[model samples]
Target: MARQVISPGWKVVIGSGIGISFGAAPIFTSGFALLTSAMAHEYGWNQTEVAQAATIVLSATMIAYLFCAWPLDRLGSRRFAATSIALFAISLVVLSQVGPSLSQFYLAAALFGFVGAGTNVVSYAKAISRWFDRKRGLALGLAASAQAGGSFIVPLAAHGIITRYGWSAALLSFAAFEIVVCLPLVAWLVKDSPPADASVPDSGSRPQIAEPEVAEADIGAAEIVRSATFWKLALCFAAIGMSFYAIAPNTMYILTRRGDVTAADVAWIQAIGAIAALFGRILVGLLLDRLHARVVGILTVLLMATSMLINGTATGVATMAAASILMGFAIGGEADLMPYLAGRYFGTRSVSKVFSWLLFAFCIGAAAGPVAFVRLSTLSDSVVTPLLLLSALQIVPVALFLSLGRYRTAPEPAFNLAAAPS
Candidate 1:
């Protein structure tokens, strides 16, 4: 029997991609960055304070990642994703009501973070893992690319809305879009994996299909906590996360303030970054399928470091856009590579929890990065110092990933294609 070139299961990848693309966009750092200037001007808040609100949002998401992982494992992803989108929309609406009081802004941010995990990569990864075993990397690459897809467009649109209507209106518009667009797409299309008893199409030759070697014993959360690999992964992610958070919140502001770029110009540059990120996810996904993830991870980080150096010395649009592309690639690589590593090393059985722990570490760094950049930039009176530091920090993850042990490939199992369902 000739195996189907495309599995019906690819729908899961598409659905999850759409879900994450639309759902994660508005609450994402890029979206928040669009509001930063407006909020600061209207409320007399500093850049640091605006970024602190973003930190709170991420911090809340981090906490949610910890508690929700187990529940997700037990309850399945469909309802959680749907409900989270709903709650996320509500959070946006509430945030749109922010006044001069900084306390209210923080409170809304905390709420957004609390409900934000459902729309995160963690939730979608769980669903995608169940669908494809051999083509997991590409599937995840396609799904994770949705983030960049959304980031590409959301910031541009949000900036336009903020410039014309007001920040409050921009928030309200995003909330409405989330409800009208993402909610229905997720509800109608997204679902958990098909039943194990079902005949799923595995990519292979007509005579034989390679079945993945399933582990007999599932890895538990406690074992992961005790392992040296886990700590290293966590620490590496934390550093990268901090760098991302710091840069994302400041990208437009830095360009506008230092490079003399206007909001419209910044919007177009950000869209280019999003495109770079989209390609990065696709490239990383393809590379992970063929090469050891550690090798790919190291190379990707080095590329990011190069971008950071460019960004630090950027003098105009040409240089800044080049830097943004590199930054986007780095961000996209992190999103795809980490989850792929978790599934490969830890076993899909515990990927949700394992990746969540890693995400928590990332959040800690993310929370710290913005504040640190703000302080450092304030003290130095230039953004270049902070950019260079972030570039330097990429080396930490590169070193850690480089030191990782080679993956112990499972023995491939022989299959009788006639006996198996096509």
Candidate 2:
């Protein structure tokens, strides 16, 4: 692909998008599950409650993201995200002050979940998709990888901080970190569209100007809502949320079941997994640009299935490490692909709103994953088996993606920057 026209404004969008991805990642992912032993030990909470809270957090996130979707496009990504970021920072601090009460913990988790829901990869993906098409997947992937990078940094940092400092101190530090990291960047650069995005270039020397495109008929969203592509993508993405979040929230839980896996080994596995995700995200981003989105998606899903199978059949320390890394590959790829595919099919006009709705579907899957896994595991007294079954569930998304190949995005003429803007 030719070098992407990354003007100064576009660069800022990518940076802020990365911040959004990173700051938003830690709240709902395996962070709690990884730190479960430390949290439970400190707060004197039971296993069931702790596990249940993970589900609640995902549930809260699902609902919040749904609520934020269309409003975000209308309210503006920057404004919507700003409020959510503030909520996340404050929630973390308040959560640290939480006592042993289940209700309090649940409330904290809900706030955290809600904040995370509003500020996520979808927003970042939409912002980038508006600016670049040729390299859209790569840009989206790199921004998406910020979340994976956060998954790496936050857990390790939390583990060390909680081990050294108390949970309250560590949490205060976490909140402070989010405020410092997300606020200034988002406030500065998170615009809804590029200056040229909504305008057309004039033929010769006519000066160009930014204008929000208006379509005739003002097509009611309900009409778009009823399309076959919509439901297929929604269901597929939701399935993705299920399989991915299930593993994310349960990695440490599954590891803890065994007595011999050392902290050093777990740390190494997690670090390796995080590192792998960065590459995986970048690879999918690159691939999505050059290759067929759904074909690449199918391959990535298969790779993820293999990873899940490895996770299911785990015996000792080595297999666990490999599984974590393999699973990371899937998470990273899908993280990149979802938004890229959205752009490939839907275009930038309503990308944020579309992705927001898709993410709501994703949230439903995400919420069900960890909580259901925990519940079923408790009921059946089996962890690995229940999780392994989720692999089969992922196949449905692969089929849905295949069906999606027929849905093509409009060929919006690329903004020829050298030409006069109109």
Candidate 3:
């Protein structure tokens, strides 16, 4: 049989990728850090205070993920994603209106975190997986690159807008953009798989529709938690997250603190990192499809740790820029690995739920990372100790992954075998 050309499934992959990027950018690391700096300067809030709000947002998101998994699976990806985008846009507007009230800022961030749960990696991972089975790693990486892409544009835009019209106006504009641009695409393009009953197996490299029986074999959140493999994967990701997130919120501050680099320089450096991240996501995605994920994971962890060490000791612009690139590359692979692994090891039926648990660990790391860095900085009156400590701590995940032997592989019944349509 001749191979079929491309399929419409690629549209879903493309749309969800852009949607996730749009939904995540404003509140994610790069954009959020710029906003934090603006708010801190305007309100006289310290680094710890600004970082604490982020911690609150992440912690709330972590909790919300626990409940969102079922809703994501049940409500369908389109509705869930649309709602998440709307809520996120509203939250951005509220954040803009947070003019003299720290309480309002924190409240809005926490709300964003809660509603933003559906916009996380889990939202699109299963949906994309349903569309493409053969190169699922690359598909997920493509989706994740949206986040990297957003990081590039949003932070640069946020910084420029804040510089011109003030932070409030910047946020309002972002909200407007998200509603007008992102929501429509998500509504039009993002969707769950067609019912398995009438599914057709596509020729060529098109993803085969999964068998209902195979999907049904997937365990629930309760069952996943009971398994030892689940916790190991969870903890491993948490450690990676902790190390990377420690630098994310502080990158601008660290680069500019010594007066060697200006705000514009920081923006450019972050943009560079974002670009590197996009490539990293795509590259790792391709690699994961063919290579042992554990090996890929270890390399990513090493890059992250090395970046931390460089950032901790760097005194020049070139060194700081190099550190940023390394960090970005590591993060690109790191974010894609967990979700890909979860669905690979577990079953697709419960991908949203299983990955949600992993996302909770991600959120914990994100929440703890910034505060811990800021607290250590304040206590020690320097950034050195925190960076070094985080760099050293990367070992936890490295060790955990090294021992993640059987967990990375599929269970007794191979899910990969069931990935193709009957």
Model 1: which residue pairs collide? none
Best candidate (score: TM-score): 1
Kindly list the per-residue Cα lDDT of model 1 for residues 187-244, writing each as its tens digit.
7766777655544534443322223325435787788788888788899899888888
Model 1 — TM-score against the truth? 0.92
lDDT, candidate 2, 1-422, per-residue tens: 45446554456456655565556565446356656557788778766677677778888877876677676767776777777777788888887888878898889888878877766776566556655555566667777777777777766776678778866777788788778977778877777565543322112223334322232223346865977777888888888888887767666666766436765566667767877787888888888767777888888788778887887777788888788788778777877776666555665665666777787888788878777777777887877677678877777978887877553554233465545356
lDDT of each: 0.78, 0.70, 0.78
- Rank by lDDT (best first): 1, 3, 2
Across 1-422, the per-residue lDDT of candidate 3 in tens digits comes to 65435355666778888787867532577788888888889889987888888788888888988887888878878888888889888888887888668888889888878887777677787777666554678888888888888888888898889999998998899889889998999888776874454333223332344543354565766887888778888898888767777778777767776348877788888888888898999989998877778878888889988988988888888888898899888989966897777877776676787888898888888889878888888898888888888888888888877876544334223244446468
Give TM-scores for every candidate, taking all chains together and pairing residue i with residue i: 0.92, 0.88, 0.92
- CA RMSD (A), model 1: 3.1
| Ranking, TM-score, top scorer first | 1, 3, 2
Q: Native-vs-model 3 lDDT? A: 0.78
